[model samples]
Target chain A: MAKSFRDSLEAGFTITAEIPPPKSVSFPKSIEVAKKVAGKVAGLNVTDNQRGMMRMSSMAFSHILLGVGCDPVWQICCRDRNRLALQSDLLGASALGIKNVCVMTGDYPTLGDNPGAKAVYDLDAVQLMKLTDGFSNGKDIRGGVMKNHPDFFVGGVVNPFYEPIELELLKLQKKVNAGAKFFQTQPFFDIESVDTFLEQAKPSGAKMLIGVTPIKSMKMLKFLNENVLTKPIPDGVSKRIEFASDQMMEGLKISAEFINGIRDRVDGAHIMPINQVASLPLLLDMVEEGNGA
Target chain B: MVYNAPAMIITKKKDFEEILFAIGDTRSLFLLGCGDCATLCKTGGEPELKEMSQKLVAKGIAVTGTAVVPAACHELDTKRVLRKHKDEVDKAQAVLALICGAGVQSVGDNTDKPAYSGCDSLFIGNSKRQLHYYEKCSACGECVLNDTAGLCPETRCPKSLLNGPCGGAVGGKCEVNSENLCVWIDIYNRLKKAGKLENLLLKISAPKDNSGLAKPQKLELKREPGR
Candidate 1:
């Protein structure tokens, strides 16, 4: 059996992958993808309506992954639920034996299908982590004691590419103080660009996992460059995929190379497949082979 | 009675068709407008009242009468204004208020007939000039203006982030609405200028206690028994 996600983090080098839950009720395909990368990664993180698009609740999907013997990182966000619902969901996740959680202030509601939906950001990311910390101490947010409280491994996100990088570093410090055990950063393709962020963050003593998403085509590269990334994709990285005969394989190679370059600098890598979950096992193999060479 | 207060209670007119649909079967209508905030917004002024009255007349609905209340949000003032036009108020089946939410409710509370709002209450704002306004406060019930160097993240930042700026800001502009500068960055600069950056860096804001946002908020000032 795979080591628990906490053990993997403490062991120094770890690998995790994020799988978005399905939009529809059925999740056989998601389970199958989780099974494929079961032993290959330290944990599988199921996203909570990533990009503001509604999907199956990450809690339900993570529970399913846990049942299949995969360590599941249940991601919870503050966009849809107020504090009451957030607290209730945390207790529910604990009752269901979902041990690891990644907290975020999810994408705004208008970015996805439901532009008319109201956003409820009652608690930001740091506050959510603080709430999770409260759970581990057997105290609810109101200071009332519960008969049995949850023991959770809490995590948060950082955006290394965000300019005024001081702002990002400050939030990183806050998250660390709020009891974030580890962090998964926003997708970064270059290692050197984030060195300043890593240097500033090292004092916090929180484990850092660099986020990587393997691009499958030119169109995706363009979309991410224009709409997603704060800093545009490095010209060299973009050109390699743009000019490649087989862009998919080239994209996989770029991700592996990027991971291999940063593995020694950071704690580990978080592979966000971006709807390409089936390619994860193969991508992991490529990274391993490159490290061996 | 002269003051330099920015402004309050900005409102915008809803589509005429929607208003028409809302007042179905009410052939006779009494139009009510506010002389202060709504008049400044141009949605409820003498011209707008006359324009609305004409539109209703063109729609084959009788215009019973119209009055611009000096302060429609004041319940007593609204009642006094309606009394001046009691004959018109009795002839009209319903009262259509072209003012802010508080003004509409005041009219509703003071009248027996159905009351409908002809405008959407936007936000408490500053009038840069006539017909040009910008939202200044969201009335979140808790103010953080001191920490932010006098800029309101609650009213300005789309995310209402308390700790700091989110990752989406680029070129000091917000990702949600690119036209607006990221208020946090502005706050940071202001704090740096004010030599209070350490306070922001050192403190982690607790989650807001939103209980104050509970609906139907009421306030009753205690007073001496015999003043």
Candidate 2:
């Protein structure tokens, strides 16, 4: 059996990386990258039509990862599916032996390539997480008895960089109440904000993996800072990246620095490579070196 | 005046075929209209009610009576109006309310006769112009206008996202509507204009407190004896 992400967290500090599925049908390139990182990290998170752009299904990609003897964190976003569809997908994931699941209120459909597509957010993240919890306990969301239950180690997303950290903390508490076993936050740049979030959220007793996105270029850093609504890249960091002769090297250094800063404070680090999927091995090496392990 | 109580907006007029089918075999009808909302919407004003009465009479049905109340949603006012027209109301088999859903309920509460809605209650909004009105508030119960720079995502955004400008927004317009500005983007720009982008950065609104909006909401204040 594949080791559970929750168990990995309990054993010690864990590392998880996200691999957004390709937009095309062919998965040779993505599968190759997953195979390389599968042994380096505890698990990999397969994004579901991330940014509303149509990609191969996260569950299908996860099944592929499982075929290759890898543990996959199958992310289920609430944006695309209604309750019935979501419940059905959960059962399908469980039947395929996909153990780890992450629940997110997905990016709006307008953000994707198909801007005209209708969104089906019949359940928000909190409600969806609650439903998954029901499935694990042998009952459907309506309290109907189930002949077989799909046990999942459910996770949720949080934004430590979000302003008004108190509200985020309250949401974290609510997610915990709704059955989120672990949390993966938006990428963090300011260490003080992470410290403050940790101080307030410590009482919730939920393990959290701080997000660390490696800046691939100056434009990428600028886009994340300006366009991304949830996480903000600080001006000081952006200025540093702008001045660097080699932005990729600067970004890797910053990613490693962020991981090192929060390694002791957080339960784990979630690395999002964005478009630079090939850099996963190098990023992992830098993280290990930063941890001095 | 301290509270900005919601004002109803005019709704779509029910199709005549549907109404005839619903009233089924009833010859006489009592028609009710709202002078406020239905009048503004051109659905249930005195003119529309008179037109409907003429249409019903033309279709071989008796128009027992018709009254345009200032606000059909006001139960006590509707009750008094119905009492004044008790003879006509008693003669009718069913009362047709040409106002919003609340008005239909109000008319039903005021009379023993079966009340049928004549127009759909669209939303709470203000008159954009003489005959134009846009939906404004969804009454989500927990208001976040302070954090959103007065533009409401709950009512404006198709998704009602708390944290947003979800990736679909293109050219400052909503992905769903395309014609309307994405409320999240509007909120961000508005905050930036006010030089208080810190509000957007600092506050993370939780999943809306849906409990505060339990249906049929009631509020009571302790009395300070007789004035």
Candidate 3:
């Protein structure tokens, strides 16, 4: 039997990488990329209509990853479904033998190409986690018994850089209480904040994977710093990336250094290359070398 | 600060024609005003009540009496105020309540006379100046203010999104209403100011718990036997 991501985390440092579904119907490129990193990483997380843009459903793409001999972490966002639809999808995903799942409150629909689309946020991340937990326990959201329950290793996301760290910690506790077995955080630029957050959150007992997004270009770094991420990129890192002749190499080095710095503190790292899937293998190799894996 | 409770803020006064049409053949009327919400909203205050009385009299309708209660929604206070004006209330054909929906219902429950609302209740909000109010809560039953740096997306966002600066927001303004700040952006900025920006990124809030918001909500507190 293949080891679950949770088991990998418990055994030692785990590595998971995200593969965003393509906007088009074709999956050959995405599947090829998954096949490349299949054995190098513990699990591949397929993003769901990330940023509200329509793409191949995460569930379908995750199945494709499964066909390529990769364990897929299927992401389900609350932005597009009500309770009924969510429950149906959960059962369907499980029936297909997909075991790992990550629940999130997707980006608002207005942020997507279909700005006029109505968002169906019938449940938030916490509630969805609880609902998923219920499914694992052989019960539906309404407490009805199920003949076949999904055995999912459910995970959630956290941001260590969010302001009012105390409130964020409280929310993290709520997610834990709601049954989030693992957590993947937003990208970390400053190590100090991650340490502070870890010190406080360690007692919750949920496995955590710190997020690392390798910068592709100076413009990408600037855009992420100014608009995408709430945490401002540390000036030192930005200055390094800005001055580097090969920005991608600088970003990779920075990410590997960061992963090395916090490898002991966290269970793993979730590397998100966004649309730049080609760089994932190289980044993983750097991380493995730094970790002596 | 000991007892901070929700208050209703009215925005529009029913048109005179609408009110007269609602009164419908009721020649005599009794007026009730809310000293708290309606007074602040300028809809059912003492001055407005007196003005309404005059308007009714001009239309050849008899205004039997007028009384402004401390809070028209406070059933006990309204009951006491109505008892004091029992004779006038009993004489009128119908009662015109220039308060909110709750106040109108309170009057109806306490009086035998038909009760009609004269103002439309808009939202649970506050204002710094007269005739200008801002909606702050939708009473979603599930509050996520702690996660959003005390900004409410359920009411502030045109889409009532829990996770957002929906794509429609431009220049920090809402896509639906350019004059208003995009609540998610405001939340992001506030979280940034408080050094809690990571809260927005980390926490994926679930859908609002609307089950607790079923209408005619009632709450009863437990009390000690000898309290």
Candidate 4:
């Protein structure tokens, strides 16, 4: 029997890595990286034209990963395609045996390589989730048409640290109503902030997968805290990275330990390493075997 | 492309309130912002312009009528806005340009009443920075992007030379121009490199309806849902 999503997560701590697509078709670095994490991790995510940079399309690249024995989660963003394109892509992905999907609203193109390129936001992430579920029920978003549709185990993203967590939770409810099966969040270096988000979002009844990317040093912690959104490295998490003689190992240990701590709080942990995707297998091993959380 | 660059067409509550104060007791005014071109320009979308006309009511001017019609320049849209407000516009001391020339004149065509340009008519251009401006597309009698590798010859090229490679394009630097690409040279090398020298030989469509000359052109995009 084909493995189900619940079973896939139950096979132990689910570790997913994000592999960004290359700038163009001529580049092979992205493909090379996808193959690197095939059997070692649970699934590899292929981002479509991340940050709006033109790349070999995500559909083609995710199929490439599937060919290499890796389960790929294709990110379908609404920044490029309309409802027709978005629904068509979702239905097509199901035919190709790509089951997992991560829905994002996508960053503006003005923040991307081609700022001059037009951005087509047919539906936002929450709206898209609802749109797809409606399709599965043999209905359209506007309830005007009915057609063949495929079942998608769609995922949504949230930042636990966004100010006014209440508002974010309200949006999360809408996303769940749209038919999100699972949710993988932005990083949670600060357990306190994430814990607050968990309290607010726990009611959505989604299979929650909290993100836990460990830091390397005090400097790295500060950079993420100040520069990145809703990702502040708490003092306790920072101290683990600060005292280690080997920074990289310390980062893995801290990340693994953090995931183990809240292992009961959320269903899975998506280990996102800025450069350390290769460290994922070892990190998961530590999470399952270690006594520390 | 992506019009992500933000502009402030909205006056703050304080500023707009003050505008109401300035026009106190002014009545029977015709305030028209173009429905089509101004909508595209983002200066006066129908929603905001409607709000503006509605707000003008406090000063005794009730813009009870509004027309979100096509091309303020087109006699159709202009006539609609004016005729709908004619009694009001005729009774009023002034008519307002919610749109560009085509709209203002449409109102002016029937009345000896004064017309005001509420929003400045900025020629088709791009904002250089927040609140900063620069002219880009001049609607020169030609569009040379096809030959110039998607760059316009009149605006970007130093000399507006259609055929010859301008010397200003040395090392990709425009001679008389500061940092912008030299249009003709870009065209010459682009066509030559793309093996499309014949495309450069092909004449381009002459710029038309620019300078607000002649009548305004109309564009309609129909989206039949679920197609």
Against the native complex, each candidate's DockQ, computed on alpha carbons, is 0.65, 0.08, 0.12, 0.02
- Candidate 1 lDDT, tens digit per residue, A1-293? 59988899898779999988888888787788778788888999889988889899999999989998899999999889999999999999999999999998888888878878899888888888988988988878876886689999999888887667776777788888888889998888887776866887888799998889999999999998888787788998889998999999899899988888887788988999876888888898898898422
Error of 2 at A175 (Å): 1.0
**Compared with the true structure, what per-residue lDDT tens digits does model 2 show for residues A94-202?**
9999988999888777767988888877677777787898899888876898877999898888866544444455567767877888988777887887787778889
Error of 2 at A148 (Å): 2.5
lDDT of each: 0.87, 0.80, 0.81, 0.63
Candidate whose TM-score is highest: 1
Which pairs clash in model 4? A261-A293, B32-B98, B33-B98, B33-B99, B34-B98, B34-B99, B73-B102, B157-B183, B168-B175
Model 2: how far is A285 from its true place, Å?
2.1
- Index of the highest-lDDT prediction: 1
| Backbone clash total, candidate 1 | 0
CA displacement after TM-score superposition, residue B223 of candidate 2 (Å)? 34
B1-227 per-residue lDDT for model 1 (tens digits) = 11233458888999999999999889999999988888888889888999999999999999899999988888999999999999999999999999999999999999899999999998988877757789868988999987888999888987788878766787778877889998888887888788888668548888898877899888899998998
Question: What CAPRI grade goes to candidate 4?
Answer: incorrect
If both were scored by lDDT, which would come out higher, candidate 1 or candidate 2? 1
- Runs with alpha carbons beyond 4 Å of true place in candidate 3: A291-293, B1-128, B137-227
Candidate 2, clashing residue pairs? A52-A112, A110-B168, A111-B167, A111-B168, A163-B201, A163-B202, A163-B203, A164-B202
Alpha-carbon lDDT of model 2? 0.80
Best-first order by lDDT? 1, 3, 2, 4
Give the B-chain TM-score of model 3. Answer: 0.91
Among all windows of 10 consecutive residues in model 2 chain B, the one with the lowest summed lDDT is B1-10
TM-scores for all predictions: 0.95, 0.64, 0.64, 0.57
